[model samples]
Target: MLALNKIRPGVNGLAVIEREVREPGPGEMLVRVHAAGVCGTDMQLYHGAGAFAQRLKLPTTLGHEMCGTVIALGPEAATPQGAGRVKVGDLVSLESHIPCWNCNACRTGRAHVCPNTRYPGIDIDGCFAQYITVPTSIAWVNPPGTAPKLAALLEPLGIAVHATLEGRGVSGQTVVVNGCGPIGLMNVAVARHFGARRVIAIDPNAKRRQMALQMGADEALDPTAAPPVQTVRDLTHGELAGVVFEYTGSPDGVRNTFAMVGALGDVRWCATPGQPMDFDFGAWRKSRPTIYNIHGRRLWDTWDVAAPLVYENHIDLQPIASHEIPLADSPRAFALILAGEAIKPLILCE
Candidate 1:
């Protein structure tokens, strides 16, 4: 088998390499990779650009958001917690985080932030290969007949789900999504699907703003030109949005969040910036809105929020899948993303 390997640290270290297929060990299973999505985190790893990438070692497989068919299961002896849930020929989506159940974060209902996390494509071999091995615990069974390409996005969509539905009221409330990247745009659709009264999508990129419209946003704005707070207020007839979602990782977006959201509204920061942001406590004090720093999906909770929406075809992912490439051509694939032509690229490894 051949896998996309990050052979060393830093940029220019990854390549396609040959490898033997490893059978599932106890508590693990072998999956035949079908469709995988190249993600921003994957790009960050490619560029060695952040603290998240610093934790990674070399000689690891290079993709994570994927869906595959279960090829083989480990012998049934004391399997992982989610074991006995899948069998040969079952199609499943991959949950990229591997958490140690013993950690305080895990024990106290915050496993999504488990410090001891094993993220494939970083901490271990990943899915950008014809065959890959993942613990049964991280595999989620998909509905029969789900599109593999869209199923590949399940992992990232879980983030949008966690950010949108994790104890915040969106139904009938105006919402502002301050970015139109793939996940950011997905957040727009998820908010709309949750029956948000008006969904405003903000981005400087014309292409992404247009994509946001396609995903069901009521309006799209050029963040640089339109004063997001005032624009949203106008769109809602002198009332600002009740919820503001920050996914731009830009300081301007952060600054605008407190302004875009209405008094007593909610603000959720879902994207992590490359640098620490300086925030004003004064605006936050005045707005009096609840703020949430959205970590990744809330384990099984976000999955439950996402699965039905995906299975029911309520949230569309096709428009965001801008490019598809073969695993051997992943180097070019990553380049395309860096070049900004492809927002979400899918790699077909099988």
Candidate 2:
């Protein structure tokens, strides 16, 4: 099997090499990798960020967002039935992280926050290979005829869906997305499709601003030139955004999120700050805005609602995928993402 792996910790140590995949054990399924999507976290791993260097066992395959077909099922495993159900030859997208079911969060239906979670391509071997084995419980079957490339995007799309659909409906509300990365761009499209009357996309990149508009943002502004809060307020006719989704990990963007949100509005901070953000409680108290720190997608049933949106074409992810490269060329793909030249890069493993 061909796999892309980060063999050791360094500025650049990722390598594409061949490995032998052990067959599936009990309750596991052997999946033939079809397409795997690269994410910002993968870029971080390439640059030796996150807990990858510490938590990951060495020489680990590093890809999480993946779509595949069940090549073989282990003993006691049975496929589900329905429009999008897993079976032999069924196209499927995997939930990369499997939580320990005994955790407090998992028991309370918030498995996304599971304290003892095992993530593929991070904590274990991932799908940047010819074949990978996963617990059947974490796999979701895509509807027949769905594009393999598109199906590979379900993981990150689920994140956007969870962020946008967090609280009450966003229909006809004024919304602001405080980043124009791939997930942020996905939020732009989801916000519009969910009936946001005005969508403000904030990013420092001029290209991303244009991409945001194409993704359905009503207005795009650079946070560096003009203050994003002021621009958003001006566009909203002096009314601050009813909802703000912060997708940038930058300290400035975090600070601006407090200013851009309206009084009593709900603000979903969706970015994972690489460092501690010096947030002001004074501003938060004055505005009295509701703040929700969104992590990964919801645990129990979030994917059920989210998957249909893509399948129904309510949110188009095709534009967000800026590049498609073979698994062997993953190092260059990492470079493009690090350089901010690629939005979402998909790695075709098969």
Query: Quick one: best lDDT, which candidate?
Result: 1
Candidate 1 per-residue C-alpha lDDT over 1-350 given as tens digits, one digit per residue, 9 for 90 to 100:
98988777777588899977888888888999999998888888888879757877777788889999998988761364665888788899998888886789988877889989888888878899999888888888898899999899999999988888855668989899998888998999999988898899999888888899999988999978868778787787877888899888878888888788888888988878889889889878987889888888887888988988888888878988899999888788888877777879899998
The TM-score measured for candidate 1 stands at: 0.95
Indicate the residue-level lDDT of 319 in model 2: 89
Give residue 140's lDDT in candidate 1 (0 to 100): 85
Q: Candidate 2: what lDDT?
A: 0.84
For candidate 2, write residues 141-245 as lDDT tens digits: 887898898889888888778888887658879999998888899889988888889898989988789899999998998878888777787787888988999
> What's the TM-score of each model vs. the native?
0.95, 0.95
Give the clash count for each candidate: 0, 1
- lDDT against the true structure, per candidate, is 0.86, 0.84
How well does candidate 2 match the true structure in TM-score terms? 0.95
